[model samples]
Target: MADVMDIVIVASAFGMDAVRAQGHLKCAQASRRAGAAGFEVRRELFAGEAEAAPQRLRALGCAIAELGLWSVFSTPAALYTADGRLDAAALRLAFDEASALGARFVKLQLGGFVRDAAGAEIAEQTQDSNVRLVVENGQLAEGGSLTQFVGLFDALAREEHAHVLGMTFDIGNWAWRDVAPLEAAAQLAPHVEYIHCKTTMGEGARRFSAAPAADDTRFIAVLDRLPRDVPRGIEFPLDATRVEADAAHYVEWLAAV
Candidate 1:
């Protein structure tokens, strides 16, 4: 029989520093704007350095499939501030750091809403890194529109750049565009390399949502439609209190998949 497919829940949202706390390692923080709740690492932590964290994760008895590298405001749009354009250099550094740590993928935002020279430059630098770049289709203002994002996918899918680039489609982002998550997944499934399943709950203006990433009906429908080879991940943010409980919920929900 084929091995059962498994989904990986990345722990970076809990802060790199949280990895040291040992108490709140599985805390949910994917929803935070700052993504700085748990632990914060000033430098990269490689496979050897991360062994303790991973071992601790294993002891929790939850299946962690793989580790993900995450960054806040590291996109092309964020490269330039009052100082100068540093997106390329920063990305190179970040990618190398992620790669050194044995991370399977690196998650990044496009920087800003506008897609200009800086955006192009950022994308170019990502392509140059030779590591897998998993683009998150969230926060639409920052070149996150489905149409524009697909354009990037198409460009990257070309013969010359196809192997080095791909996408990490975040299911809930489309809901903000008023597009159904399943529909959005259908549209981008072909270009997707990984998946982060979550949901937003709002109607006519005032709406918020939550998740057991793989449990939501909309997310399940999207998963049903997707090719099984794609790796799906659970991502959500919760306060420190819900860490263990939420991780258990996530593990149970993932098993249902």
Candidate 2:
């Protein structure tokens, strides 16, 4: 079994966009102070700081767990030209960023079919690179649903790319899409290599809250179904004034898991 204490603190939880607007150095420093095993790096959070960000994070003893990119491969406008084809150039850039960050995996949202030519191309391209690719369930329609993920993985299996591809399951995202977390967990556990731990409250306009919220028992069920070896991390909003304390609480909560 894996030690839950190894839970990472995702940078975005701490107002990452705002931090990026200012800088990434502070975010890295703060993560270290909070005693996180590592931090998930979103491309937006390192806009102008990518060159120096890795070194700074390393200096503070923070590892780069994953590199997040926001490309919708299904949409020609997003990753391809008007002719409607995979934009190898854009895809390479995403891989390049993941490589530069030294992340174990490049995490992306599953916005389309894995059986698509572009998706197959992604698997082939990634096989030659050090950084692995993982698709996550995003909280919007564009992101894809649990059913879509199952189909994607099944297709990857048929193409023999399932061994190379994996998943990053977001606990709260199931709620966002109106899917029961535990049900999704049972179906996606086999491919999950990373996890996003957070709880959501309300219905139409849901909001993020720390894990283990009184009304949210989904985490308990989902956690039980997850592979113990995977990296499970907190991805909820953090109180800036109590960053360290908030982070510590999350770690402690995971420890008790």
Best by TM-score: 2
Clashes of 2: 0
Please give the CA lDDT of all the candidate structures. 0.50, 0.64
Q: Which 10 residues in a row give candidate 1 its minimum summed lDDT?
A: 31-40
- Candidate 1 per-residue C-alpha lDDT over 1-257 given as tens digits, one digit per residue, 9 for 90 to 100: 22244455445434445644543223323312222211222233223445435444333223222223232111222322333333566566557654443345555554432222244555667655545666667655454577766655565455245445456777766666777767777777777877666677666466554574443566777877766676656555534576555655664455457
The alpha-carbon root-mean-square deviation between model 2 and the true structure, to one decimal in Å, is 5.3
In model 1, which regions exceed 4 Å deviation? 1-3, 12-87, 112-131, 203-206, 212-216, 238-242
lDDT of 2 at 64: 29
Give RMSD to native, each candidate.
Answer: 8.4, 5.3
| Model 1 pairs in collision | 15-39, 16-39, 17-39, 17-40, 18-39, 112-142, 113-141, 113-142, 202-207
